[model samples]
Target: MPIEPQALRVLMHLVAHRGRLVGKEELLDAVWGNHFVSESAVSSQIKAIRRATGDTGQTQQVVRTVHGEGYRFVAPVQEEPDAGQPPRESSSADEDGLVSPADQDRPVVAVLPFVDLSPAARHAHVARGLTQDVIAALSKHRWLRVLTGAATARLAGHPDVVEHLREKLGVRYAVEGTIRLDGERLRVSASLTDTAAGVCLWGDHFDRTFQDLFDVLDELADMLVATVEPEVGYAERNRSSRLPRTDLGTWDLFHLGSYRFFQFTREGNGEAQRLLNRCREREPDFADAHAWWAYAVVLGMVYWDTEPTTDLLDDAIQATERALRSDDQNAVFHVLHGRVQLARREYQAALATNERAVDLNPTFATAYCGMGDSLCYEGRYSEAIAQFEHAVALGSHDPQLWAFRTYGALAFLFAHRFEEAVDWTTRAASIPNCQYWTTAHRVVALAQSGHVAQARTEVPDLLEQCPGFSVDYADHKLFYLKRTDQRELYLAGLRSAGVPE
Candidate 1:
């Protein structure tokens, strides 16, 4: 029953020229513009329009075909007031805005067309391009439902645009911004607002040169997408904390679980799993919820020494399978599935799956990290390091930054680059709320670099966090590594760090 964009356009055009025949060529120009699509495209759109409006070829009650000429709207139609007019006040348009009961379950966001603040109107295209780029980039994530910019374009100039978006479009978050041109230089200002809560969650300004517009657009888009996802997550987590337990929806619970999962502690992992379980219970078919729950279970197994029983492994596998079955195109789900493959020592399968994840979302940092992990296990250290670096660059400020850095250090160690391993692991350890496991890598790297004294000093903390750690445990952790020499070298470094035999 959903009207597609092209069909909606056709319907609107028909309504505008009601009672008059609109030529095929005119319809093409109005809808597709300069695009060279075949007449079948228009026919298909007309068919879709008929299906959506319950009009039939036999009846032709609404949209009448003109046989060889074009089409006409035979049905009477009414038009709303022009968008330029002041919006009429309704019960839904109170000071804040109305929130639909259904929309409360998920985060809805809309990216408004950027305002052009250039002295010359000729640079308006640049502003529009940036807005499109941001919307395209953000649309790659499956978690947030991103509304089309065109849907909110008219409301962008309203004094109460945020409230309007919230009430009319049911948008929980609104991203609005302006672009300014100063001759050859460009500046962009953007802000993200939690419309329901009436709070500005985050805002920033970006400056660039107008050398190559497309390149600049890509850069700005990447940066904004990277920033927006985490900022939204942070905002949602804060909002979830204030809500009563009974009021929390599946999405809210998942974000709350992720906030705990990223802490990388024993208690946090347990709590994350508990919340993820509840999330899955609430929405069994939610792919993202299933993926995160599987990820949390795997992390508990790897770090928290949770029993990796057959039932536990099956739970993780089934959750991932369910996620992939629901949305195979989702990059995060593929990455989580790849992680399960990696844990099961299916190196080749994991590598291919992670590669597919990257293919699905080239900008997904976690996919690259998963690929790096697989490559490192295959003893392709240099290639793994490259993948890790790409992941780190894309996710520099992401919640998984610590994991990227730690994996990068591991890749460096496998490549026999001890000094680089020490440096990256140190940075990972220095990050706020870094996982405890990073210190273990630092100890091994220091020992391998012949800094035995420094390595010895780090041993106590690592031992306290991972008691009963041994060379056998190190070997178990590196089970995916095909090369015995690489695994042995890693164990030797751990041994030199005074880990138990």
Candidate 2:
């Protein structure tokens, strides 16, 4: 009797490790490779193999579950070569577990069907609609490859829904929820999970009156998209961190590089650049890798106290242009390009680029922060502060929270809200991996707000960490500020804080 391909692979893997008691995770790694599947999938495959071999779960003649550990194959079979076919290859049975070439390096997401859970099941339609809307919104992100709602609908009542999705569809993440309507009230609860780890990274419930269906759908879709993006990013970073560097694909490399890029230190920035460049080299057509590589280069110059050389700027611009040429519709690419534009001191153009990014994906927090940076350069400090505020609200748990808070502090400083600036910088400085600049910003805010003695005390530490930092360097490197008064305000604070001229 012929067995399904997956079951055949499972049989081969078990036969290869017969009597060794392969753990679930080991089986997943050896049989499914990079794909993630729960223990249930392993059991399912074993059952199929046993049925083909005239064995039952009760008999335990072919395979045995070790209970809380793994499975063991007790019965062994001898390998024989058929005369009409080439000899069967030995010891390479697990190669089938590796991801296919086309699917390699692409992270997939599945939005499973939402359960109605209403008393009368009348909210089924609403739940389905919400799932579709969420899938559509998540598709706009460009980084995520969202499986269609219809495709995931088959998994509605599976005992292992997330694992089934991961196993069958190669999904790394899953979005699942339920919708209920009772009288005039509507409630939708949603969660994002890392299917591999079987962990929920984020979950929330949206409660609204059942007045306008479309309005409710729109609000929930926006919230899910905004929340999912950052949470998925955080999950990806954590996953990549635990994997061996050799096992990482281009997607995981990009995530790892992003984690490093946000550390806001010179060494971390250098590592980020290296990792992103490796991603670019491995997958030349991966536009996001190119975009992030460019951003990593720019971060070193702007925040990590590195020299912003003309050659570095040119390389960054070229990489950004390449990314846009490949995927012009990516809001993140536009945001990164805008950052490079900001570094070039083309404030208006950067602003327009970031505006286009926001138009592309309004839920993206970094785009708002990019717009805030451009606005601050144009001397619209109040508008800039508002944009930063909006961004912080949208992505409170963002991995780049340090950068956002630091930017908000700069906006407050430019607006001459000295105490608020001090508060913002103090908070920013407290966050792990925040840059040396947070301390600098705090010092400036302190000195400007009449706490001169306290500000002077921080000078030694700042100088020690960021050698050669002086007001002159700020004047020369911080060309994004168009107005002389704003520039002088920054320099004057540094001077008052006893920074070297």
Candidate 3:
């Protein structure tokens, strides 16, 4: 702790020169600058530097004396230029690793995957559900990006997640706790810990009747969100946006639709679409029902070029309007409407829709993706990257993997990370019933990324097969030819990428 200033400089000098053998005379010259210091002083300072840096040993030297020459700093270094890379190894092994990963552009948090503390009590389901719900709950917060469950699972344990969270999640704090059940009551206790100082910022417990599972889970989720919101420091929307509603069935239906829509197949699409439709019928003014229905339309048409109904688009517009009418603050519904508009070639309308959606729910995944799509149509690439990255943070369900890949490709293409674009688009091609939009992006990505041969060979059939043969081709242009520059860039990219004649 009392290493002199001279010793501190010496240790840093060694680490700064992680490799390359430096003579002890060089160290003295660098730190002492020709001062009349004795060789003994230099040797003593070297020892102090080594000890301070925990480089314990005569042979195991961080600063090795080259027998008659001098000392050299010895350490293997690995640093990736692309900074968003996830931690490759645990930082518990590195004494100097302390930076948390909150890239100013992307909010970050860690999900402490629920631990099955009582394998005997059979609470795995409850625990897993709680963690999942908490992630979902935290997700609704506009200011924080919760680390995906898989990323945070490596950080699990009683207080085990503390430091791991700071170093891994790059979050200032983490939400962690345990679950228990006693006869008729369900108990949950959670605390948010500040990783930097290792202190508990907040904690709460909820106890509810066995049948009150829904309410208890929601309350805990709410508490977790509200507690973290203040700490995250996000600018809030107007009071109307923050107002709570009494409606529950609509949200229930929405979650159900979300749960079922993930199969990425025809039937999964049909079931989810039907439930959302019924949801609107049961609650005529529920905007989300209509919005989701529009999304369903995209999937349904995955098998044909003709639309389900001539008024299918009109239905989406109506539902979005209804959602806004009942609660203009509902960003999700507006985003749904935007998705329809984007598909329909109404780029400006789509952009406005997503802007409002983002204003209402900054964390909304589809809203940002919609905004990205709108910008892509308009050829505004940089802004699109920022928005799409947000969509990735918010996370979409399985049905959205294709959508994700599409956005990822766009993000890379527009941002000029062309190689990455090709890689993501290639992955997207395998998605079940991948839409033309996905394939089209892949075409462009591959071409621009220097895989022009493959791009040219695959795009024509893809573009011709737009909408999986389900779109109302008469109403759908299947390509954006709004700007000559945009059209040229696209066509050139596609040609280079392998779009057929």
TM per candidate comes to 0.76, 0.75, 0.45
- In model 2, the clashing pairs are none
**Residue 131 lDDT in candidate 1:** 84
List runs of model 2 lying over 4 Å from the truth. 1-103, 118-121, 180-186, 206-213, 457-468
For each candidate, the alpha-carbon lDDT, in order, equals: 0.78, 0.79, 0.61
RMSD to the hidden true structure, all candidates: 13.0, 9.3, 24.1
- Best-to-worst order by lDDT is 2, 1, 3
Report the C-alpha lDDT of model 2 over 1-501, residue by residue, as the tens digit: 778888877776676557467767655554565455677998888889888988887898988878887778888677564579642221111245433221234567888888999998977888888889888888888777777776677778999887776665667899889988888788889888888889888888989996877887788787788889878777777777777987676677888888777666788889999998997766565677778888888877776655788888889988888878866788998999999999988889899999999898988889999999999888898999999988877766677777788988988988889899988888777777777788888888889899999999999988876889898877876755668888888889899989999
Best by lDDT: 2
Q: lDDT, candidate 3, residue 481?
A: 32
Q: Among all windows of ten consecutive residues in candidate 3, which has the lowest summed lDDT?
A: 97-106
lDDT of 3: 0.61
- Residue 367 Cα positional deviation in candidate 3, in Å, after optimal superposition: 2.1
lDDT (tens digit, per residue) of candidate 1 on 374-394: 999888888999999988888
| Clashes by residue pair, model 1 | none
Give the clash total for candidate 1. 0
Q: Candidate 3: which stretches are off by over 4 Å?
A: 1-260, 298-310, 396-402, 411-417, 426-440, 448-450, 456-481, 484-501
**Which candidate, 2 or 3, would have the higher TM-score against the true structure?**
2
Please identify which of the two predictions, 1 or 2, would achieve the higher TM-score against the true structure: 1
